[model samples]
Target: AVFLTAFMPDCDGPRTRVIEEVPVSDWMDSVVDEEHAPPSVFLGPEFVRRKLYQLTSEEDYTLCQSLARVSSYYVADQQQRPPFSAARYGAVTKVYVIAKQDLAMVEEYQRQMIAGIPVAEVREMADADHMAMLSAPEELAGHLADIANNYT
Candidate 1:
């Protein structure tokens, strides 16, 4: 299971919510540009069709149909409580794979949500952006394996 604690894409939430207090167009541009690269590389026509089919197959198309609808509601939702508070698992270990560069902001938000999580390990990679998992998958995977070994 993954607990994502960050600004939500506008497409998933309601409007009139402003998380970063930034202009709507700027945030939209950033999110789209960030995801566009990988899709261009990996998401060919077939992949696009499959993804569209999957979305249409889902019953929640009312929500899905409003694709790219920007909203800051997710931030308010996250701010109200911790990301993992509603998780199904109890007493299960969790690894927070955060970007090294985002440590400051992520930690600040985490502190507001919960304290004393006993970070089992922290892997800091150099020159990695917010999307470190995509930017440095091998390095991230290696770190994850190392963490898993420690538990075993």
Candidate 2:
């Protein structure tokens, strides 16, 4: 399993949600409706460019902008759910890919998750952002290929 600058949870008890270390002002550009049940979040273009696709080319970000959608970040469902079984989830070896320029999750928070959930290997890309597939596809693919070759 590979976690590419993604939130990783342990196979233990409750699944702790990743709290955004960024300030409210940082997300002010994005649309967030707290009044809605469970809340709705729409990652605006400017916010996405700065936070998610900072390392990507402007052309690329613009090209993919139309595909973006409004979504909700509800961890309550995950929190209420039971943890994954060690016999299943923990049985698999996990590899984590750290994206240094990821403003969304940030590098420090990524390291913390890795520390919490032990992984077989850890890889990092200094040039990658939150969307490493877009920002650093070649590097991300290289890491994935290496992981697959070694792990599988």
Q: Which predicted model would earn the best TM-score?
A: 2
- Count clashing residue pairs in model 1: 2
Off by over 4 Å in 2: 19-26, 34-39
lDDT of 2 by residue, 48-152 (tens): 888988888888898879788878766555667888788888888999999999998889889988997769999999999998998888888899899989998
> What's the true lDDT of residue 71 in model 2?
84
lDDT of each candidate versus the true structure: 0.39, 0.82
- In candidate 1, what are the lDDT values of residues 1-152, reduced to their tens digit? 22223332222223322244444342222232224323211222232223222323233333444453433334434444433432333345555554444432344543332233433444455533344454455776787677778766
What lDDT would candidate 1 get against the real structure? 0.39
State residue 108's C-alpha deviation in candidate 1, in Å: 4.4
